[model samples]
Target: MIVAAWTVCAGTVMPAAADTDPRGYLTKMKAQEMWKVADGTGITVAVIDSGVKDIPGLEGRVLPGMSFMEPPFERPDVSYPPHEDFVGHGTTMTAGIVGDGSAGGPRGLAPGAKVLPIRTSVGTPMAFAVASEAAKGIRYAADNGAKVINLSIGMTQDWPMGKIKPAVEYAQSKGVLIFAAMGNEGEGNNWTNVIAALPGVLGVGAVDEDGQVMPFSSHGPDTDLSAPGGQVLNRCNGNKDWCVGDGGTSYATSLASASAALVWSAHPDWTANQVARVLIQTAGGPVDGAKRSDWVGYGAVRPRKVLLDHEGDPGVPDADPLASPAPAKAPTPSAEQTAAAPRRVESADAESGLSWQWPALGAVVALSLGITVLVKRRRR
Candidate 1:
């Protein structure tokens, strides 16, 4: 069952000379103010990427999830303790979602939230095979009780839309809020891949400490919001010390997912639609005649606004904020609609000033194993 698919790039990690204040992003995003109101106390976020390790920071916070990778591979074990982050990417994402700073490590936005670690990849070596099972992983998360699904992975080309749409719809139908990275090729086409561009998905872009969109953060009309991703610090696998200078829309997606968990935990009665609407309406963005910017999406996500301020209208509770107009009901599908391939362009990974050529396009999708990790001075 090795289906041809795109490779998954591990999130970039640049070592630092000194330990960054793990709460740096939370302070900048004003997450501390919102914590008084809610700390995502009753939420579960699904981390669909490389496996998550049971690190000290994530103790008692990670729930068991299934691994879709084939056996005897890079990450062979697939059992109850699905915490074996091979590339350190998924572990960082999980830490960003639910880390409680229990071990004097980096704290997450939603420290009270639990993480469902669904291993979909074994790092870049098996990216294509891992991507082939992404849709199934999404379905498994939704059915198993994930309130939010965090897909921090992306490809230059859209996965066959037909293969992904139903799974996305299924998750949305089950009241799951999905967030995905817009890609890190902002200097290039910045095309929002199919998964992020899907109607119900919340596509996230990266912003730096100064509240500016990163040059590498992908931009498109499908972008839903922006979050602190550039130079953010997170835990690395097998290391108690934190890794700084990590940048990409992948980290932004996890932060946004944690933001949703915060709001969902505060207002558990609100439907997924209401939560989505609140996030969009309250986001901090430019006012272009009340329209959102293609680069920064609706604006930088401010969970504080949604949690502390309770006066804004959340609009329809069941209506999707990103839904498109319905097509006329038809008994049969149109030939053109069924056969058309999505428009796509190729791009390279430009993280940390290093460039790598990706696999060529074809029926067989392959991802490049060019994850950039600069080993600078170690930070405690």
Candidate 2:
């Protein structure tokens, strides 16, 4: 039941060129132009992670949310502002979705979207005891009007998929889009965590400014999309200044969620499946033919292509994008089966592990400065 936040930090400060726009991923993804069409005006994205802080960049955008952390660790109520970010991970994820960039602060992909923060213990000593909280959080978000649910955390221990399937099904049934991070374990085998492997979730991977899949980004069959995650900038804990060296599939998950918001806001009538289809079809990859790869899934998310050019066919609005014929009954994995799976390393910094070399592809590189990568450690 132990869960870990999937984020990494770069030890160095942001490069001088990144100062022009701390959130350079927006420009690279053509988000600025898309904003003219749709700025996620009426959407609400649920950030289910550690917790979201009410910073100036996020300001009034953060709504009251519930915390499953318990006792003195828990907040007042669901109406209470979730301003307790123990590791700054949730705040960074929130900034990726809703930062207004006012006063030269970090700008989000969906600056106009509202955030519903649901705090869970994704990276704490008590994480193992609160696994069911994630499932409850998803159901709560869907019932309370969350259009998109972003889970920037993953379980480090092997838990029964059944524990979360019902909640995931409930969210999908309510027309909510869910995105989870493909863990930052590279090819280390811990990347395809249970949440990422689920049928109804869109598993996201990380790519650098160059659009190259980061060496540390997880790769597996479950990865549904890729986004700018390497060396991305976000707010630091208890500080409004941008933390320039943070990167991981966690950031990519937030960006992908925001991209969904932009598309949904623009086409209010489109179903979650249709929005997902558009993202998959319009994604920019190494080659048009190689749209789905183990490394980057359906390729780098290009919301602008979907928003500006009105590209791609959003096939079957009501169809589930990740649906397979429902098994007679979903088979639950045995404890032994779960244990056999590669468990994530438990560490304070989840992405600071040994680097795996990935094949380099020639692509246009964008210069965006900001964070160091921290690797997560395994629980004993």
Candidate 3:
């Protein structure tokens, strides 16, 4: 049973200032320059989250996907459309990947791509059910022509092995790349992310405009790369459009998924392994020049290096860069270790019904200070 209390850290808002075009994240990644080459055309990113609303920015872009929140999978009373968002979290994530900015929403980094909405609960209380649905969602996306799957949701607890692992392997076998959030536990909770830790899945962490990793972003060997998740502008629920999603790995994962869409669209013939390899090779490594680190993994994702500079070499088509050597069978976790494991670190979904505000300068300073100490300790 889950022992830790469920928690969602309050984020400091940084509004989409009029000057920050296409949102701060796109600007940081030099997305405009890359857009001149490819805008995620001919790509479909499956967003498995709360749900998606067919907002104006997403006009004619969102496909009618399936929902797992009701009936056979969930309570019959909780039914809703795949196009309807439950908490606006999924809509924000969807906008991050494919919004066109027609309704004053921040334009998505990959505006030319399409979104397949797989509606499911990402709230804290339904951990087991969510995991089952998430695994199913991954397989569904793989079979239904999605080139990439975005799971902006994560859980602290691990479900049974066969559920999530086999689904991920199936998706990888079908050449679909899954980008999952590394969670928002930070240093305090520091839970191991279940889906993100799986083999062949790219576990994404969050970074800010200054390129420092966000304090709320979970860190570990599973962290494959970082992306701009701070001061990011996007449309919230129907009522509150244009709220900043700052310091959550959910948005970071979405942006990473969009980045994959960009790379894949540019080279339609490339396999999933090639796309995955090129992304890692082009990523900006750790400041100390290390090949990899637990904090930001290979470092912040810099797709511009591949798209604009034509830098990355798409390696062997069948070779998986994220794959690890098969592990020897291990002993089961001790009772003490099992009891010590954190249980309900919340999903990395952005806050709903947030009022617009300017960037919190003080919070930014705190983040920097926190990272400084964490880095020193991590090095040791």
Which candidate has the top score in lDDT?
A: 2
lDDT of 3 by residue, 211-316 (tens): 6766667778788877777666655444366655463677888888998999999999999877877777777666554566676766677777778878677766
Q: Judged by TM-score relative to the true structure, which candidate is superior, 1 or 2?
A: 2
TM-score, candidate number 3: 0.79
- Predictions in order: lDDT: 0.66, 0.69, 0.67
Candidate 2 structure quality by residue, lDDT tens digits, 5-60: 35544444454246434466777777779999999989999998878866677888
Q: Which TM-score value belongs to model 1?
A: 0.79
Name model 3 segments beyond 4 Å from true: 1-11, 14-22, 71-78, 124-128, 234-239, 324-380
Order candidates by TM-score, high to low.
2, 3, 1
Candidate 2 all-Cα RMSD: 11.3
Record all residue pairs in model 1 with backbone atoms less than 3 Å apart, i.e. clashing.
7-367
Q: Best to worst by lDDT, what's the order?
A: 2, 3, 1
Instruction: State the lDDT at 216 in candidate 1.
Output: 61
Better of 1 and 3 by lDDT: 3
Least accurate stretch of 10 residues (summed lDDT) in model 3?
371-380
